[model samples]
Target: MKLTLIFLIMISFLSGCNKSENDEKPEKKELELKSKEVLEATDRFGWELLQAVNKEADPGQNVVISSLSVAQALGMTTNGAANETLSQMLDVMDFGEVSEMNEAFHNIREVLQTADPKVQVDIANSVWYRQGMPAKESFGEALEEDYDAAFREVDFSKKQEAKDLINGWVNDKTKGKIPSIVDEISAGQYMFLINAVYFLGKWQYEFDKSATKDEDFTLSDGSTMQVPMMNQETDLDFYSGEDCQAVKLPYGDGSFYMVIALPANGIELDEFINSLDTNKWSTITDNMHERGLALFMPRFEVECKFKLNQTLIDMGMELPFSEFGADFSNMTEAQVFIDEVMHKTYIKADEEGTEAAAVTSVSVVVTSVGGGGPMPFRIDRPFFFAIAEEESDAILFSGKIENPKQ
Candidate 1:
């Protein structure tokens, strides 16, 4: 008999400007930097994951994923991994060593959750195991102490009850943006590791709704569609590269930002995306300077869902999903392997601001796995965007916008 372990991750971001005259921005303390390497590794992993998912998506389909959410879930799961399975997971995530990974993640969560007083960021983790399942003491301690996860015991025999308990937590964390993630729980599934992230921030500079008007937006195939284009004029951090032009839209005192990159005329979106790498990304971001600009962007909404089992495998993380080759002795005495990795996300951006949410679940019976800016920046065509923090440069959410109507 084989037991399964399931992991679920959910992340959400909500943005809008509702500042009153009496509202004064509070002075926020500087976030101490301790995990520069972990930040870099996670950002690199984010780019790679986005590229991989893009390769598998149909043309013109918008894609979004929360890299931080996925990393946190996987980081918790890695506590139980051993031998080749452990090494493979670490390598795929670009985590060079395990010594400080947990500490780094904990620090990251603390900083991100409290980065900006005006912004509301919440990160929560929990573990639910079958009533009789014997999870190692060390593993539980690592989750509770390092990851700050809440532990519970559920009877898997009552599948509906189990589903409600897990899904209820996901819904609560996301503030109902994501109502549920668990549709069913099989008898073989013995445990679940879940991570949920929620973010809500008002724009530092809000767009006037009255200025929004329908405008022509060019499609990838030389076609055009009319979209509700939000217009604004202000000083913004901008970048002009050989292949693309970019802009940064700060949220709540500039600790977090949304950066948008539009491909230059003659360059296809796919072509530019394929060319993106860590070095190129650094160059683009590092070169940005404040410039007075006119900006036009569409009010768009995007939702994406993906099963990342094959994607992770293609990225060289294989053994954890292999039934016979897998080893998770550190987690439990039971012999188990991953079953699926489910991810879902939703984002809505309007004149007031943007709201986005994501959920990723990995079942090890189960196996699973798992932004933006601006400019005169007329986003009149398909472009890439990311939501990231200034201190850590940690990418919380990222995706491409092909059509606002969809």
Candidate 2:
């Protein structure tokens, strides 16, 4: 199937602060579209987030974005004929020059293969590769798995089995740090179609046992709760906003960042969440000027699973995957339509904190750390977080921490 991530340049104004925005369209709008479908997938949730997965902020910058699609990728190849929705999506995917990178492609294959002797990955995008032929060959070889229907079309009706398969792959890929994949899937017309899954996580310098302690969590809507808070008193880039305050905690060798959001008092939980917008996100990102600040957050983790069917319906994207309105003929012999799309994610943070996992279909990878902080923002009630590349502002991971110890 085809996948797209179109991160268009969007602009908005925060409530109080009229943040200056860069509306000047980039001279080079070199965006690849099939990926756009994948990027807009998050429109279902205002608070939901998907960002870039850049290497650390140190010297040699490396990036890794992993995506597992279970739909059109297999829809057009298998099934009564793979799903056309996914097939048409992939029609324009550019493989670029990655087909040339033999060594690098081999290494990628080794990593994925060494990781899963059972499951195989197939990459078919016409995307460009900058590292010349070696890198191209690496990608090509890494994606050289023929269709056998094992990891091909997913049996959505067999939900548990579906979860098991994806969880297995994600668990292996994340080195057990995260398990962000479901076992099965189902499309109305087809009992078994394709699916896409992804998982990513990083340890920002393992938390010291002595640093965690019980603390108070003040949520919006005037509610206060007690929760374990992770205390790491280090200098960092901090923002104290009128609507909501935020703290950027560096993570892993400095490639990505973990940004925590604590809403202002008197703000209702639903109200605050409802108020979420690109402008709010933009405000937080633009205010990311590195500043010396201390930080502390409740040591808590949460596991949340959401059936995004209705959520997607609520978003403006009800056109492609709708029951009566979907148009996916390019993928299969049948008029393939999107039956439903589901999502489940989990995260835990405590004294020896911050452990989380999620399951979904898409691409992204991030782990950054090259800054400072000692910020204290308990997330007892509800707060937002994101895994992002500090340099480019591309967010790879984003979620809300409602219950700290849950």
lDDT of 2 at 317: 35
TM-score of each: 0.89, 0.56
Tell me how far the alpha carbon of residue 130 in candidate 1 is from the true structure, in angstroms, after superposition: 1.6
Error of 1 at 84 (Å): 0.9
lDDT of 2 by residue, 211-310 (tens): 6677777543356777766555545666778878887765544545577777787764444545655567778767866665445666654544444444
Root-mean-square deviation per candidate: 7.1, 16.0
Query: In model 2, where is the ten-residue run with the lowest total lDDT?
Result: 125-134
Question: Using TM-score as the measure, which candidate wins?
Answer: 1
Model 1: number of clashes?
A: 34
Reference-based lDDT, each prediction:
0.80, 0.40
Instruction: Encode model 1's per-residue lDDT on 197-294: one tens digit a residue.
Output: 77777788889999999999998777999999998988888899889899999998788889999988899888888778779888888999998888
